[model samples]
Target: MGAACIRERLDRALCSHPWIDRFPDTLVKHFTDQGSDHRGLLLSDKAYTRNSRPLFRFDARWADNPEVRAMVNYVWKEEIQGTPMFRLWERLKRLRHLLYDWSRAGTTNSLRNIKTLQAEIERIKLVHPVDWDEVRNLEFELNRQWEAEEIYKQLKSRVRWLKKGDQNSSYFHTVTRARRKRNFVAGLRSDNGDWVTEELGKADIATNFYQCLFTSETHVPNMAERVDNLPISQSITP
Candidate 1:
């Protein structure tokens, strides 16, 4: 019966933690309490799951598309009434969204249609290759789709040693799976000296370790000190 705009907005995802006030990972479901004026909050007892962030990389295939080039050129050259930095930032933001939209609209549908066309070609061939021209046309379409697929797979696998359009989608898939498996840590030791299997805990440990390792510390050796400490003898100096 009570009106709360923030409460209404956050009904699905409760930002406040169930136990501790921490970084947002909370979700809630509200239900009517029997004989009560206020709705009861049901806190999720399960561990919070982290959403996978999107990875955006440039696809070489898109470069060949005249339309894609025109789109990029148009967006890049759009005049914004602002200071140089502001204009650049706004343009970059727009470009990011544009590229994301473009990528989402890529070869998936074309490849799917190729499969359907392949089935149709097979059926027509069995019936007596009367649709020879149709088959040839579909083959051309398949070739185009394959090219896009190859470019996509190559970008994903980073295996540029092989020539393009070699029908290496399976190889690229295997490489990607293996890379993910190799990079994934099932568990990691936390600062508390316990094995933490939680994704958030492991991520925090890794982030902290790398940040500390890369950060400039209070006590550190400079390039001169590093040179002096080298194992090479003064007699063997170049």
Candidate 2:
């Protein structure tokens, strides 16, 4: 930061074999210093763009809603033209779309509602003649929404050992945030030694890598030859 500070260089990129295999095209670019004494280094790759669908996760909070159950029942009853397994898959696929739409239209945003209710309650209390009835009603609604928010956090945190009665919403929130941060893949090295930071590039890299990894490169062995080579008597036993 200053001349008095001993001059030293420690900036470097460290990656393992698995990481290199995943993104062989990883490239590092250096940039001129803007304000800091140290210059900036960016890992990047050839830009790529593609449309991707968001992943669907069934919210546990939906379990408490009767409408969700009814929707699922209605979807499950539909006779789809397919094998048993295919029919089940089709039913689930249809149900997911319906549930997604229902969830989008439903009052799922408890946190915002909780804050609004709290503000309204505070405002009512400031009146010269306190409206106890209104305050009580708002307080009840606030608690209900707060509980729903807590349940949402609890499900996200995935703390199986923690009981629902133990209302540690803040703890659950912290755990959920930490898990998401740890699990998130910010960037990936491509085969060309460039970092794939864009969502589309990263997705392509991962998909290609796994596809190659799982694909059978060797030709299928002859079953008859393998059976004849078995460590057993060829003639019938006496």
Candidate 3:
């Protein structure tokens, strides 16, 4: 069929379909070419899919606990004392980095070295299998270390912001949103299989605060309600 006739047909179909709103976003078009013998029509629609899974979050409040602090210190000392497993891991890490550098430099020798190291590691694993429980413990320890580092960084950043005497409300709001997003993503996978998106609750809280702050009303009907139980102050009475 001619390009003009195909276009007209698609236009008519779009007009006739009042229930198009129910359907996903889509488009129909005719393609005419100088080289090709025939004209073609294409229809496209968007596919909806679930979001990626969120990572775990460490409890920052745990840092304040004496027992947790002691455990973290003990772990650090043990790591410093370097077991045979730690040596092996360090070697493996160095070898991997070397291979990466070589690959980026486009060197065949580096590529060969990476393959050799990988094969050797696999062979060792096959010969003497590592304990799954030990692996899990190590992974958990690594995650804890990373979380501690992040907490330190965030605290430092907050301190710096405070020292600068910058009372930018937007900055505080951004940090608050980030914390909420992280919390929501963390609570996603509980004991049950259901996915819980915490943003719904946080959104309500945020919206109320935003309206209270921005609205022109001189008296925002007990501003304490808008702050969501945050400890601001009680009162200044002589």
Candidate 4:
């Protein structure tokens, strides 16, 4: 038999029923062939736990609540005995924890709230009396939720051309998902010339690299002499 080069969609990923059941949210991605004739496939589970803690992001929607402003004012007014920079840093750290705690309890799932409010409004309309007041109240809440959802997606998408809360939630969502996929780091190459695919391994590699980079092993005994030795074309005399 002789080998022939031809373009065809012959490569595919196959999985057993048990495997699918175990990783229900698994996503398969295709990569272009580098040295081989066939494309490479990567499988990732969306629900897999991440090794590193997620970074905190401020949600602009939180500003809409009057209580959030009051909370910030209270945190800033707290007394802390320290140098100017140290006091500012401590206050910011405390404010971050305070806001995080408040946000966890104060924030509602906007999409879920929107759906629930919509359902309730529909139910209210179905009533024989059609309680107009109740429907109006529900509608108002639904609109607020919709705005929150829009602001969230807008922030994620980083798209500012279109004004947020203009009912372009779907567009923003699609852009956000695309950006996330583009920015995702599936794997990394370690300093030991090894591929690190697991999140923990990649994190370790990054941590070690940065630790070595920023940690100074040698101490300078004569810092003033070293600075004075540098050639200077011009000097300022006071």
lDDT by candidate, in order shown: 0.66, 0.74, 0.45, 0.74
Residues 171-205 of candidate 2 have per-residue lDDT tens digits of 67666655653465668999999987777788789
Q: After superposition, how far is residue 109 of candidate 3 from its true place, in Å?
A: 52
Off by over 4 Å in 4: 1-49, 163-170, 181-238
**Reference-based TM-score of each model:** 0.47, 0.51, 0.19, 0.54
Better of 2 and 3 by lDDT: 2
State in Å the error of residue 80, model 4: 1.2
TM-score of 3: 0.19
Best by TM-score: 4
- Model 4: per-residue Cα lDDT over 22-126, one tens digit each: 665576777887787788888878775576666456788888688878888887898987556556766766877877787677355687888888889988888
lDDT of 4: 0.74
Error of 4 at 20 (Å): 20
Q: Mind giving the per-residue lDDT tens digits that candidate 1 earns over 139-209?
A: 88778877777777777677887585576467677676555434545579988899887766777797687
C-alpha lDDT of residue 138 in model 2: 90
- Prediction-by-prediction clash tally: 0, 14, 0, 0
Model 3's lDDT to the true fold? Answer: 0.45
Residue 52, model 2: lDDT of 67
